[model samples]
Target: MNRLLLYVHFNKEDSLSTHVIFQLQALRTIYSKIILISNSHLDRVSLDKLPYDIFLQRNNKGFDFAAWADGMRMVGFDELKEFDSVTIMNDTTFGPIFDFASVVDRMDSSESDFWGITNNRAHSADIGGQLRPLKEHIQSYFITFQQRVVAHLSFQYFWENVQSYDDVNQVILNYETAVTNYFIQEGFKYGVQFDTVSEDISNMQNSDFSIFGVKKLLEYRIPFVKIKAFIHNAEKPEINTIFDEIVSSSDYPSHLIVDHMTFADYPDRDYLLSQKTLDFSSLKGSRTRVGIHLHISCEDEIESFLSSFDQYLDNYDLYLTTSLEEVVASFDKKVKEVILVDRGINAILAWQKIQDRLVGYQIAGHFEESSFSDAIDSLLKPAKKIVAYATINEKIGLVVSDLTVSTRTEPIDEDSMWPYMAQLWNMIYPHNEKNLKKQDIYVRSATASFWYRPKALEKILSIDLNALVIQDLSAMATITHSFSNLLTYVAWANGFDFRFSQPHLLTGFEVRRRFESRPFLMVEEPAILQLKSSKAKRIIGYTIKRLKTIVKKLKY
Candidate 1:
């Protein structure tokens, strides 16, 4: 069967992503010809490397629908009409999870003039500048048209009249949803491979299936899943499980998903935070190459601060930075190195002076004067947890402490600092500033204390600290505030996972119990003993669950 595939792609980075490359490779098996249309800032060098028979590069004025129209126009109506089928798809989805050959083969046998993997059920929506009810239509993300539909003048007419719209809803309602309605009205039959109406309908919308019913879609062997599944609806526990489900069910490389999520904008920053956090409370001790870089400006708090971390000091080398001669004179024990910087140099500048020490260590921590004194006890568990996590998961490179771990009583007013941070971020990552803002990815350790891997500081270390602070103390403070929040973006931009450290959230007994339970399950023991332990755990869990239910009932 002769088939043509028009794939639209857009990336802020001006380069193709691993998943898109994988998708093109997969689609090559089923499509006779593939055209890659990009609405990104791809240069000729990047465009020349695209794995497609043809390429279309244009300004990103109108989103996917406009890209599709341009692709159709480039192909010309006469050439497009000759193909047995034409499939228009976009980079907004993750896969061809199941083989594209199988999907195409199944759809080939269908007699409908048009088909899609799924459909948006008839619903009310804003269209052409007003709210109105609309008929069901095939989603534009992936739709296949029979040769007859393409040859029809109506199809040509549709493309000829396509206009660029600034708003995406205008593109969706007027083009994506409207196209299907237009074709059906022209007497063409349409079919959907996975019909939402055939499934459970109570409180379920077909439009939400790509997100909420992704597991079910994979179960049914659908070829693609929306990327939005991972980007939005993060409040749902089901969203967190999508990654696991995809890995467990398909042969697709899981790293593609991980790499994308690291940079992709997730609206719910907390959800993304929860996704990447490492909690290795089960580990016995810190073994990974670890170092703590402490900057002491307050002479009075020096002894107390060191005393707070005394228990964990022996496990790792300690590096200190200070301008106070008294601090250098009085500090001793576990001191691997000490560097003197300008008296008023910010912690960031102090960190920069010792950037040469970042190598060889798998984990590095930063702390400024009095940053952890108020919450030292709360900081201990996370310090150990970060070490354990770094030892196991190399992907996680940065972990900032949660607000509860600091003396600050309110959320960081990031909006006030955004302008300053934006300037700093632009200086470091010029190409990514737009996306950084669009993703709303601001996160910071209010006290400027956090744990990070050495590699995550690669871009940050390149920053010109002297230039940043040459103006005045106000410039110094602005840069300091900006740098704290920008660290999260810096980690992510460098393909490292960023997480939050939740200190003091669990009691000592609870932490110990949680950690103990895992090893207890793993212990090599008699079959009877293991079974009894498992049973006891189940009974304990059930009893706790039931007591909570009873409490709720009594309160109600």
Candidate 2:
């Protein structure tokens, strides 16, 4: 009896993705018979050069199911039943990402007759056996079948009845969801790498080894991770920091990941080449694919801000006080797009001019010339209608969960000119019963720059900017600060909500339940946390000196 692995690989670009190539190296470890089933329209000459057995098929648009079924057809049922165990896998993920062989080795000895790498309760269909079970549906990315289960009459018929569909939902309903339900009805008990379905998601039990759990990152406990999860806040520093730490401790090449990302462009010349020539032209992967357009109100220190981002992309549609213009020749692989407001008018007006232009983009943000590269990453990670600020401050309240805490980073008094501005702010948002608290509404920073979907600001932008006049103030707080401070409120007034960029640094919700007197740590960027957590104290001495007061006040 032997073990076999059938890998289903496809891409719309007519070539295998770099992520697939990385998975192949690990596949060789556990499978006695390794086969690749490709539906991508790749060059035959290049495909013929691959080391493993290959089955090229027509692109039926059924997702992974079509590839797997066609590949199994190549390996007749007689041959499939001969193997002691079988695993059906696909290129939809980026692992046995960490020692996948070990995961297979453990499952080889598992008590259950069949099992999947993990299970998820999400995306329930609720139609009884027709849909996935309420408790769990063994995830289909990589599932193993013992010989006893493989030889079952039902197993063969499952594939015989399997269908392919152009509609994505129909495909999932037919294959991914159908397989798990079929298995459970056949009286087979299943297990998962991470049992988070029963455990609390916040705590790292067994280091939380599911494919997508952020906690499992500490141990690389789970072998495969769905590559698409990296798009949002799923790429948390707290999670990836553990993975990077593991990589740093090992002899493995970090460039493998760096290179895999570069080759992710798909349809590259070296798609099937065993030996890839790294692009020496750029020391790092290009940031062209990872991007967000920055709309800066005409502010000084623009050069300083440009230097802080990963790439200095000058691509923008500039809007002047009188008209709009595009900055040409600024477009390159490094930039997605850039928009500039030439007139040194107020920030809100600049945001208004570009509101319509930003309709199509899913993620975009507003920035003062005051953000760092790391802050940009944090801002872009959350789901839609998200208002992620650069950092959290405690000037508002002791509890982190309390959203109505004071945002006053500075003081205002009866005689202060800001007090008069507060009166004006009250006049604008005034409803005698639900009056906007002048203090809690203002953010910790005097500046109001945030990242959110462009459409969220449509209601606020509709207000006539021309009717408003900025009166010069003798006080330190001016009209600019008052207008900028309304950002959070504007978001709340709309249907959006926000989370602080670094909740781990402050009193976590669990900790906030207790009345501890630790001063709130008000950090402005993710880079500051890196510096604060640095083992090399001397490296961040200057930054440390400036932050001591902020950190000390919180602890005392």
Candidate 3:
């Protein structure tokens, strides 16, 4: 078949990723002609590497639909009719996990006017704070149009009228969802490569098949896997199973997925840790050298902290930083060295003092004395597992205490620190404007305690302390909260994954289970989520409000 492929792509970095390159290389086998339309800047070097017949680099105003429209126009309506098939796709997925040629050959025999890889069921969308009903449509990520459909006047009219929208929901409501239905309403038959109706209905209704049934799709030999399956459906433990299946079932490079996960803009900090969590019990007997930087701003928790370190000190080197002279004699293990600094300097600056010593270990951990107020023992609870995981995987640049995962309900006060952190981020990554959306993606532990590689800290450590500007914070705590967020950002930005570690016994799930098993667990839930999820509660709440109104009326 003479197939024309229109591939739309965009990224914050404005460069081609290895996975995208891999997809294009595979696609070249099935596509007779391929046009690469990018809504972002791509330098000559990047343009030269793509396996495309033509490349269109345009300003990133609209999303994928606008790019596809431009691509169709560039091909010209007359030229599109010549091809047996035309496929419109985007870079939001990682594949061909299955053979593309087989998929194309199978779909070629079908008599449908147009088809897509998957069908999105009817669902409600919140557009401008108003819930709007969206009709079921063929997913926009991968849709192939037969020549008959492409030659239709309605198809040409649809492409010609396609334009940019200020809101993506507007684009989806008008274009992505409308395109499939538009063709069907014009008396053109449409089909999907994998029909969900014949298979499980539960996975299809009110949920995305690309996300919820991705593993099943791959098992059914669907060519591509959506990236959102890993990020969005992280609560499901089966995501890891999908990753393992991809490695065992296909010749696709697994490292490319890992690379994307490490560097991509994650949905939030919770997904980051959940997707990249390492099994603590499985990793044992690691020979990697580990160093601990214990910064003691206060001596109150010194005894408890050192007591917990007794088991770990035999295998790890321990360095102490404190202002008090008497606190030096409190360790059971031989202290490698002691550095004396003023009490209020904090972990950020104190680590700056020990940069020379940082290079000696494969795994370096930073623990603040102030961070461990009464919970000092819990700080080092997962130290061994953390070091073991870091040793086994070179990609892990940082592993922080799992406090962020546990206390996620309580938000960080980034408002006060925003002015300083924003300036710091811009200074570090001036070219990447996505850095300005700091609070949205900020993932940091309240306690600045984390295990990291020496190289991950190089970017932040390179900047002098005098460069940061802050207001209304103690002279000592100026960089504490902001620097915590920046620390994780720099780690992931430099092609290193950050993980969260908690004691095996005290997992977030276990803690939640302990609370939930109690009678009063509903009190812990947010009122809005509680009322929405429970019909009985909503009725009871209504009854109470009605009774209160009656009582007030009677009293009057």
Candidate 4:
């Protein structure tokens, strides 16, 4: 017969109180003698309800449970000396199923002093003297011992040497380690039951254990306990119930219906509004008069994007048509005048108001009301060209007759402005024919456009415009030839003595021609240009020297 002694040390907060009771009840039917030792009064009362014998620790102030249990084990071992073996189980351990009796019988028959049920074990080098490499450290302190050793040696002898709880734990660990090493050294065949019928019983309280493992343990009819000491600190049930309700309600589809005309993807709204405000602010005016009829069905995009712009372009006057609060707030203290048009209002009535008040170019994208006809009509009334940037495909049939339409495409080169020019040419003539001679539209390189604009403001704006122009031309020869003609025309008109040729001279004539042409469309003073030129030369020389040094190092 194998008598099992179960011991557990826990506080009020241990999570395994209830789990231990169920395990004890299940084990009582299987094991001949089941003894439980615990420090908790609640646990004792719970155990008393069951058929198993319970030993309650009276003095709970110190870590004396190990000593108390060890003494009890000695007494029990002496009484059960005739018994084949003694099994010690922690409260957290569950089990002793399938052929556990056979295993004990085998261990009793063997000459080896100790038999470990679990394959998992650990040995510390410093404490164990000679260490036995273990597959894994046993999770809970549980062991089966031969009754003769327990009766003769006594657990009291082991406990007497242990001064503290830490010492007791270390002794237990070292004992197992020494036993494993000693068995290997003595050439003794000690049995290790790899296939055990029991599991760590307090796993219900151990949330870290896999659910699959718990299910497996339960399936094998193994007795187990679940301890939950954290239940006292649980949040009020009402609060949890209310929170769950709110989460479920929010996830309900009926609660989240969005109007196709009103809803905009958050990012799209943000991007559009950012681009709109940035484009408006970049216009050359302190009190920039801007008319934006955001008639597109992207209310969310319009709302967020415009909200971001409201922070910066406060000085500019804006006319907007939207019911969104952010659009309304954007008018606060920033714009000279704000006209908020209700989205629900009549479209024709809104268009009339927009057309009458919008004197300059109207800023819009893909609007039915603000069409090419409307833009051309506005341009005919002495307004500057409708400077609108549109997507390459979207710009088709959007003929802004007199207005210069700035169309943009995805970037294709290091030069950021090329794509814009490429798309613009595509918009002007929606054909993909590559006949250089037959094409009426002439393309110039950004480098060449830089040399065309002369005036300061014209030069500054032309830098971007010229870059866009040159971006359309794929070949350098076409750009270079076209730039020469454009520069010659400008020189003749401006009364400057300048001409450009192949293998160009960087003399006074070339310099004069470059300045007159405003290559790169820069409008800096003569002194600034001279300084920049000298600095550029120095940078080039430095870069060349560094490249040579790197080459030399690479060669070595």
Q: Per-residue alpha-carbon lDDT of model 3 for 1-556, expressed as tens digits?
A: 8999999989877867878888998999999999999998888888777899999988887799889999989989999999999999999999998777877887777888899898877778777788988777888999999999888899899999998876888897899888988998999888888876445657442457787788778878788889887777654546656776786688888767766765675423332333444546676645456788888766687666766676554476778887777666654345777788766566777776776687678888787776654224334655666777787777778876544213323323445677778767777778873454544335565356778887877777667653342343354354655766787777766767777554433444554564476532223445434343333343343333323323333443
How much is 326 displaced in model 3, in angstroms?
Answer: 17
Residue 84 in model 1: lDDT: 95
The digit string of per-residue lDDT tens for model 1 on 370-487 reads 5675335434555675677666777677777654311343323345677777777788878764356522225566456878888987787778866767865666766676777677
Please tell me which model should have the higher lDDT, number 1 or number 4: 1
Off-target runs (Cα >4 Å) in candidate 3 are 122-125, 198-205, 265-349, 354-490, 493-556
394: Cα error in model 2, Å: 48
For 311-409, candidate 2 gives per-residue lDDT tens digits of 433233222222133222232222444554555555555565566665554334555443333344333222121321111211111001111111212
Ranking, lDDT, top scorer first? 3, 1, 2, 4
Query: Among these predicted structures, which one has the highest TM-score?
Result: 1
Given candidate 2, what's the lDDT at residue 445? 25
Rank by TM-score (best first): 1, 3, 2, 4
lDDT of 4: 0.35
Note the clash tally of each candidate.
Answer: 0, 12, 0, 23
Q: 2 or 3: which has the higher lDDT?
A: 3
Off by over 4 Å in 4: 2-6, 9-11, 14-16, 58-77, 94-112, 121-140, 151-156, 166-189, 195-556
Q: How many backbone clashes does candidate 2 have?
A: 12
Q: For each candidate, C-alpha RMSD in Å?
A: 11.2, 15.2, 11.4, 29.3
Residue range 1-556, candidate 4, lDDT tens digits: 5565555544443323333554465556546765555555545345466555555544343343353455454555456565555555655332332335465556567775556544433322333464534323322344555655555554435534433444544544545334445334544344544333244535343222212133333344322311211122122222222222322333322111111100111111111111111122222322323343333223445444445335433332344544455645754454334456654433223433454344342222112322323332222121111222221112111112211112111112213333343443343335533211211122211112111112211211222223433455454333323332232222222222111111111344444564466532232455334444534443333333323323333443
Residues forming the 10-long window of minimal summed lDDT in candidate 2: 393-402
